[model samples]
Target chain A: MQKVFEKPQALSDTPFAYCPGCLHSVVHRMIAEVIDELGVLDRTIGICPVGCSVFMYEYMECDMIEAAHGRAPAVATGVKRMLPDSVVFTYQGDGDLASIGTAEIVHAAARGEKISVIFINNGTYGMTGGQMAPTTLIGQKSSTCPGGRDAAAAGYPIRVCEMLATLDGPSYITRVAPVDPVGLTKTKMAIKKAFRNQVDGKGFSLVEVLSNCPTQWKMTPVESLSWIDENVVPYFQPGVFADR
Target chain B: MTTKKILMKGNEAVVRGAIAAGCRGFFGYPITPQNEVPEYMSVLMPQAGGVFLQAESEVAAINMVYGAASTGARVMTSSSSPGISLKQEGISYIAACELPAVIVNVQRGGPGLGNIAPGQADYFQAVKGGGHGDYKLLTLAPWSVSECFYLTALAFDLADRYRNPAMVLSDAIVGQMIEPVELPDKIEVNIPPKPWATTGRKGRGKNVINSLWISPDQMEEVNRRLQAKYTLAMEREVRYQELAVEDADLVLVAYGSVARICRTAVDLARSERLSVGLFRPIGLFPFPTLPIQWLAECGKRFLVVEMSHGQMVEDVRLAVNGRAEVIFYGRSGGVVPTPTEILDRIRKTYGRSAGVSHYRLNPGPEARR
Candidate 1:
């Protein structure tokens, strides 16, 4: 009998170290699958951030570099400039990309650096225990904002896709979620497009995945998926915000 | 065949030296006293088929250096004192990852945006690991424009030899001064093979350039390996210059631009029939400690002069270790000492032993009883 499914060749035998029910495992697989499908595993370089996905270098079969917290964009710029023929990408979280590393990401996009970015918007700081992030929604409860996020105190959530779309450097910018079968397919397609843009030398491309953090959200896996559809999808508005 | 000597500023020499040493990537931010480096690199780097990027901030510039270095590329970044302070985080990460790169710090007055004048106040920061954790940058202090070009080239070889960061710790006076320098011929660039770099794995296994050793036992092992590399450097890489030190009654210790001023002071003292000598340390990190200790053992008193309040004096004191007297004279906030001021200090120091007499010579009461 022919095998129906198997692990992507771009992934290693080492198991992922992500927390239970975290969508990072799903996104990691999607990125690995894209790398395999494009047959660019030999020339792909991945930059891992300092959040929950910091250990991604251990799971991915390609060459990897672990960037300092929030500096993945800058690191990717360095790598891509040195090896223009290689495919470079960064895997960053909400706290890593939207908060501490805001300057790095913005300038990288503005420079139109030829790189692909996989941004995970889980609405909380999953690595350091659920703390407030720049993407944390208003009236959403986190450890820092125990009562709820207040507009006066914490401000509103930042829509990264919309914010980056204003820049003229990016070739493609989209938002997607991997909540269900249909959602997973769309998210995978968006991720593949971002990588393809870089391979085609079109310049910077980013796909923001509105991921789930069941451990930090204080809900079961099934409940978190429903909460994303009712709450996150409406505010974030998943769609292609920029494609040039 | 010999290359013609050309007149250029010390900052321009840094760029030329880096290019000659096969450095193809330079990321820097504009700051005073060292802005000429990035300005010259912008025009010359691309001409040399290299990458020159003006990063948004000093922090980003150093991280870009980290990324390029991870790819086994000859990369560098230059900044002044304040900008270098912002780069400490990335420098620490680069050090932890054991990546080979060169960083130029044309130090100015500090403590907080003090001024844009020459200062040696960063001696402690450069030699004692400016960033967090226990690490050493193979620091080279150049006193003249010619030395700036030569040492900058040497820094790359030393960095690649040990797979550690090397620093060209210059001062504003040296960075801005213009002098004639004989650049190297355009020979073949011999970059060592980097088997561990994060270039595409190709036919080999995956390569990971990282510093995160979460396990305590593994982290300790990495630290031990780093220490071993530093110890080897200290043994073989200490560079210094000693003029008339063997027969002199007093030795003056200095580095960078201050050492140039001290050299003139030594000459004036010698003309006045005073037995004063100059001992200039070119390698500041592996610090020429044994020579200073040997001089002290031979009954030579030391006068440590600097542009800071007194930073390198601590290392001098440690080397002397109660065997001889160590006097410190310094100026801060960009106030550079003139040759006349140094000669006056040398006269006063030679007249009597009014400096730190070494605790062993006059011990304090035990337990203040």
Candidate 2:
């Protein structure tokens, strides 16, 4: 008998420390699978941001550089520029990429850096106990926005895939989700395409994964997945923002 | 078989030096005093088959350097005072990651965006850890256009040698002034393969990662190892050039462009029969203290003249260890002291007063000297 599901060879044997039912584990699996499929496991360097996936270095059996909060893009830019032949990718959360690291990511894409970015937009700061993130939808409640996010006060959610797609440098930009089996499968395809873009020497590819934060959303794992399907997916509709 | 000598500004020399050294990537924003650096690279880098990017902001430029350096490519960035401050976070990250790259700071007057004039006010910032954390940058202070070219090449070599960041600390005057420079031969530079680089993990078992994280114990060990490397660097990399110190009564210590001014003052003081000498530090970090102490033991009075208000003077005093009177003459806030002004001070201090006698006569030089 053959196993239908197993950890990717690129991933270490260490069990993930993510909350049970958190979609981060699923996203991580997809990325690891893509790395294995692309055969870029050895020459790939991943930059982990200061968010939920900060410990990504330990989980991914790749050369990893842990960047300061929101600095994964800048660090990834450095890694990619220095090692042009090496495949570089940054694993960042919504807060890390859209808020504090906005300048880094924008300019990196604008410069058309030959790298890939796996942006995890979970709508809250997961590792820091679920503060409101830049992609937090209107009326969403987090520890920071206890009374639900006020668009007039906190501003609307940032559609990073669309925003970044405006830059001419990036060759590919897409937004995908992992709320259900079908969405998860689509998200995996997007991740694979991002890796393939880098392999083909296409400059700057990104796959923004709209994932569920079960603990932070104050819902059961099933409800969190349902919430993503009902709320997050509609606001940040899944599709390729750019492909050229 | 010899390299040709050409007249060029110090900023231009740095650009040529980088190109000749096989530097393939440059990221910078326009700032006074050193704008010529990027401007020259803009034309030359492309001609030399390199990348030249005029970034939107200093923050973006430094991050671009961070990106290029991460690739293990010979990359560089330049900025002025306030711009350098804006790049501190990236600088710290680059140091933490142990990336090899060159950073040029054509220092102008500052505690803020002070002025676009020549100043050595960034001495402490450059030599004593400009960014946070336990790390030191290999800093070189070039006094002339030739040194600018030579030191920029040295900066790349040193950065690659130690797998560390190196800085070329210039002043507005040095960056702006035109002087004849003998360009170095276009020797082939072998950029070491970064087996540890994060290109990808294709055949090499797993992907490579450049991170600053480890467990508490592991972090401590990493820091300890870094400290040991810095210590070794200090022992081997201390560099300075001394002039006419044998049997001298007064030794003037200075660096960068100010050192050139002090040299002229020393020449004039000798003509006036004051017997003054000069000690110029080339490598600002791992400062040339032993030679300074040796000069002090010869019973020569030391005067530290700088464009800043007595920053490097403190370093001189520390190196002298009270063996000789370490006097200071400085003009801050973008004021460039003339050679005549420094000569006048040297004459007033050393010519009129007889060293140890003056110390006994005047209890505090800050009050009376």
Candidate 3:
């Protein structure tokens, strides 16, 4: 008997504090695996966002900095600029990246900062207990949008990958999901490619992972997976949004 | 090392000084008065093997400085009055994280976007608290182009030395005016290694984490330690230049470009047989209050000349402690008082042998409330 799947070397032994059936653990594993496989864990610096994963610095085996809400990119920009020879990446949630930190991420990418960004878009603010996120679907109901997101008032969901792809400075921009086995595998590939782009000095790269928030979505882990498969995937339509 | 005496604007001298000190990254947005600082860096940084970015906004520029500074690199950013206000939050965070970086403020008249003239209205904001939380920045106010170059280099040195943010506070006049500066011979100062930098947690040592933790005990400890560091900084870094104070009836206290004008005013007043001296504070924070107090004990009447409505006057009053009658003359909203104007005020107040007038000094909007 051999180990079919084991934790990546880049992750610590600390148990995750995420809710049961939350997909953040899986996403973290994927990033860790990529870092381990690339053998860049020693030279990689991670910037954690002020969301549920704010304590990610405790779990990630690499050097990490917990940034103020929506300031992970700016913090990452600082780390990258100071340590240009090192690989730098920021792990941010939709609320942190698209809402408050919008300017930071856009300018960093536009400047073609030679770093990677792992943007987790879960349609709702999971950390603050299911608040409506900038990427929330039109009809989605969260704590903030109790009556469902009204398109007339709240506007449609932001397609961040597409929006960032339009910027000339970014070397790569891709959208993926962890809703199903196929989607999860593709999301890992995208994450790996983002890191690879940085290693190759290809400039700014991003992989927006459509993650599951079973606790926030008011569904079991199994039901949340099904909801993502039926509803979220159709609207998001995951694929590579840009490449250079 | 090539050293040349050149007449250059204070803003341009700051840029050259940064480059000479081996600064390789500059991120700033354009603002009145101080626009030349970034413009000069844009043209010269790349030529000197550095990166110069014209950021979209002051906020973005400060964040960029945060980014570059985190890498344990010497980085800088500059702005005018209102723009510097916009950068306060980022500066606070930089201080919280104890990141070493330099910020230049070529102040203009303002509570908000005032004028493009020289003003020291931000004295309280710079020396007291410009950002959130209880923190202090190492602020140096330069009075001449040569001082601009010298202090900019000193700012980087002090920042790196203490692993804290340092500021070079200038005014539009000092930034814009051209003066002969004999560039100092570039000395090889050893920059302390930043083992705490987030370069990576490789085979060298454990990963370094820079964060302002939100725990009660942790926050208290952080604040206590910061207070201690500030105390040490105050004892070690207090700087000022006193002129003709050994025998004088009246002493004029000023800083930045206004101090230069006060120097000229003092020269003219001396010619008119007025026993007036000058006290110029180079470092605004950890202010040179001891010297002012010393002059006050000598029974010198103090007059504070400023571009703002007596902002620095409060400090002078506090230092004097009623030993000498402190008076003030100021013009806010981007107005620079001519040397003759300052001289006239000096004559009207002290030349009549009445000693000093005890007219109530308006506390301005900030102090009034």
> What are the TM values for chain B, all candidates?
0.94, 0.92, 0.92
User: How high is each candidate's TM-score?
Assistant: 0.96, 0.92, 0.93
- Which residue pairs in candidate 3 have backbone atoms (N, alpha carbon, C) closer than 3 angstroms, thus clashing? A78-B67, A82-B71
lDDT of 1 by residue, B231-332 (tens): 999999999999988878799999999999999999998876667899999999889999999999999999999999999999999999999999999998
Question: What DockQ do the predictions score, one after another?
Answer: 0.84, 0.57, 0.65
lDDT tens string, model 3, B1-369? 556777899999999888877788998998889988888998999898887888768887887787778777888999988999989988887888888999999998887768887788888888886899999999999998988898999999989987888999999888999998788657566678988877787666546455557698998887888788888888899999999877877898999888888999999978866778899888888888888888889888988998888888998999898888898999888888888888888877653444334322322212222
Q: After superposition on all CA atoms, what RMSD does each candidate show versus the true structure?
A: 4.8, 3.4, 4.6
Stretches of candidate 2 exceeding 4 Å from the true structure: A81-85, B188-193, B207-211, B351-369
- Using TM-score, give the best candidate's number: 1
Please give, for residues A109-219, the per-residue lDDT of candidate 2 as tens digits.
898888889898889998888898999999999999999999999999999988998889999999887777888888889889988988998989999988888888888
Better of 2 and 3 by TM-score: 3
> In model 3 chain B, which range of ten residues has the least summed lDDT?
B359-368
Best by DockQ: 1
* TM of chain B vs. native, candidate 2: 0.92
Error of 2 at B63 (Å): 3.2
What local lDDT does model 3 show for residue A210? 81
DockQ of 3: 0.65
